[model samples]
Target chain A: MIELQHVSFERQGRPILVDVDFEIDRGEFAFLVGPTGSGKSTILRLVIFDVRPTHGVVFVGEYDSQSIRESDIPHLRRRVGVVFQDFKLLRDRTVYENVALALEVTGAKRSGVKRKTLSILSAVDLVHKRDVYPDTLSGGERQRVAIARALVNDPFVLLADEPTANLDPETTDQVMKIFAEVNARGTAVIMATHDLRLVERYGRRILRLDDGRIREDMGLVKQV
Target chain B: MGLLLAFREAFRGFWRTGMVGLISIATIGASLLVLGIFGQVVAGGYALIDRLQERVEVDIYLRDNVHRRRALVLARDIEALPGIAEVNYIDQKAAAQEFQDMFGAGMLRALSQNPLPESLRVRMTPGSDLPQRLQAVSDVANSNKDVESVDVGETWVGALERFVQVITGIGLLLGSVLCLACGFAVSNTAKLMVLAQREAIEIMRLVGATGSTVKLTFLVGGAMQGCAGGFLASMGQSYASDWWTSRVPDLALDPTIDLNFWLVVLGTVLGVVGSWASLNRVLSAVSIK
Candidate 1:
């Protein structure tokens, strides 16, 4: 579960996000739809403690983002799985190595990392391409590898930012289906995307943002 | 289990960026090498001073026209002094013979008369108060007005001690500067290596890798480098000592080169500490990313 209350982030005398309040409860799939520069990714960064909120509190599990010590950020991050639009895999490593890295950093034994990596890769339908490097993979496959990596730790909440931005329509549908499956398995998923069509098709809880205000619509919300 | 896992991650990291690891090790080694060489020089200087000290003796010359029996009696009295380790009375005839052997028999024949005075050669104990002992003996001999000079190489000893002190002061300053420079270089190199692994590090941080775990990887990498450098330096020092000592036949003239336990230990500590310093800056600046 993730919660943000009256959170405002500013840098260098300019505002990035203003008084944003949102929560993703346990086992609930949520959508964050916003225009460019609307602070969607900033919100995700705040939840993960990558960047601190200037004016409000952000909580992941029990961690208080605004007041958390520098050392506690890593612990907080371990409990939350994050999928980036860039598919930030180590280019030199294989898909399996990228996924195993999550467990590896947690000080998992080699046997354990291997077991968890293979299972997670299979979950994302990337079992066969486990040994393949990121550069050799297609955009869809790379995103799948990233998903596998995010899921390797079996985090309670998954935050995805434009995961399907570079994927084809068919690949986008596949990736969305994977999110649906992950959500169905009781892992809460909060995705930030501009694709209103996917929102209508999936019909999940939607939180739209325009001019730094939360506009919640259950279904078919019109974008300004 | 924890240690094993840490090492596994370290090796895995080493494999991922083998080149970076090698460069870090090489930097650590080179820094330690410089430290080792300076240490050996100081050690060698001390040994040379010690050898010279063992062979050292002060000559006490008796006044001319003094009775031979009186001079013999004076020698016995001074030889009984508290600080005297050994006393050899080189009588006039013995002194003349020593001069002949040193400068050759033809040189002594060229002189019309033997001008060398009968002298008492004194060797002092290791912890003897050289100035006080020399003064005490000189006073007793001069009291009889039968002593010409009491030579302890007074000015020369003072100069040697001062030279040793200056060398020690300079060694400390240079060693400290070398260590600081090595630390800066190692940290900069580590920073670049961290940059190379920026994404991998982010993922590690996200997955709950403790700050210590990441830090230890770099530290261990640095330690390995230091040890390697130390070993290479030690080997080089061994060869140099052998080659140099073989060339210098007189142990008294040759400097002392020591590879003592504590010196090696100091060099090792410098290498490790330098690495630690570099890693601290590197991990702090890059951990957030």
Candidate 2:
């Protein structure tokens, strides 16, 4: 589960997010929508400790920005999956290597890393491109590799920021389908996007941010 | 497999950022080569200084009324001093012979007696060749019974010792500066390699990869580059030094095997530490969105 209680983040004396509050329960699918500078991405970063709130509490499982130790941040990150809009796959590495990296980095056995990576690659429908490098793959294919990498560790919650931003509609649907499948399988998913097209199509609970505060909460995504 | 994977990633990283890898190795090699050349010059300079210091000797004069047996005993006792390397006793008759050899006979006979006193020609150990050590020996001889005086070429010895000390000081200062320069140069190179692997790092971080695991690959890559640079420099320097010795003839520079070993170790440490520090700083500054 992820929760942000009245979290406000400031940088250089300027407010980025103010009085923002929300919570996503286990196995729930939530969407964070906002225009430029709406603080959608900041909420995801707060959960991951990339940026700390100027005030208030941000919690993901047992980690709270209000109380988490800096040294313990990495361990907190291991239990949470993150996907980037850039499809931050290593250009030089193969599809398999990129996904396997997640497990290998955690010091998983070679056999386990390979098996899990293969399973995730198959689930994302890129099993045929396991050894293909990102540079040679289509943008959507590369994004799927990133997804496979994210889900390889079976994190409790997934935070994805604009994962379908660069993909064509057909590819976007494919990527969104993968996200929905991941959610249905019991991993809490919070996706941030500026693409309202897919937002409406996916029809998940939406938390809309306007001027650094939540203005709309559909499906009561805020959680009572 | 984890460690091996890290090393694999490192080598892959090094290859991917070919230009940065080359530049890092080049700078590291150049710094180490500078250190190697300076070492040779210092070694050669010290050898020359030692040869010059060898000519400075102390003469222990025996008293005019001292018995011949007592004079010889005093000479033996003086030889036992820590700094004294060799002590040759020149009896009055031998002093007379030395004068005859120097001035072509007649000189000692013309004086009607051996005016030159019996002496002990003492050579000091190389390590104890300092002017202060010579002064201490002279003081000891002056305090001995049956010993008339201790005469050392004090002015020349002082100047030579000072000259050697200055050269050694300069060598030490330059060597330390060169080492620091190498460390910085290698660190920057490792930083570049870390930057090149930014995408790989982000991906690793996303999948629950611990910070250490993210850094391990970069460390291995940087360290391997350093080791390669060090090996190249050692080979190049050793070849150049051997050629230098052949040309100089009198200055046979040691093979520098020990220096080579240390350079390789330094290169490895510099690579690991530099990459680790830079990656940690850069990664902490970034977050996956």
lDDT of 2 by residue, A14-91 (tens): 999999999999999999999978998888888888789999999889888877886687777778888889988877
All models, RMSD in angstroms: 4.7, 4.7
Task: Give candidate 1's chain B TM-score.
Answer: 0.74
Task: Tell me how far the alpha carbon of residue B257 in candidate 2 is from the true structure, in angstroms, after superposition.
Answer: 8.5
Write model 2 residue lDDT over B59-110, tens digit each, in one string: 9898786787787777677677776778788888898888888888866667
What does the lDDT read for residue A114 in candidate 1? 92
Chain A only: TM-score per candidate: 0.95, 0.95
| Interface root-mean-square deviation, each candidate | 2.5, 1.9
Worst ten in a row by lDDT for model 1 chain B:
B251-260
lDDT by residue (B47-125, candidate 1, tens digit) is 6565555665778898787787887788788888877778788878899999988988887788898888988887765
lDDT of each: 0.74, 0.79
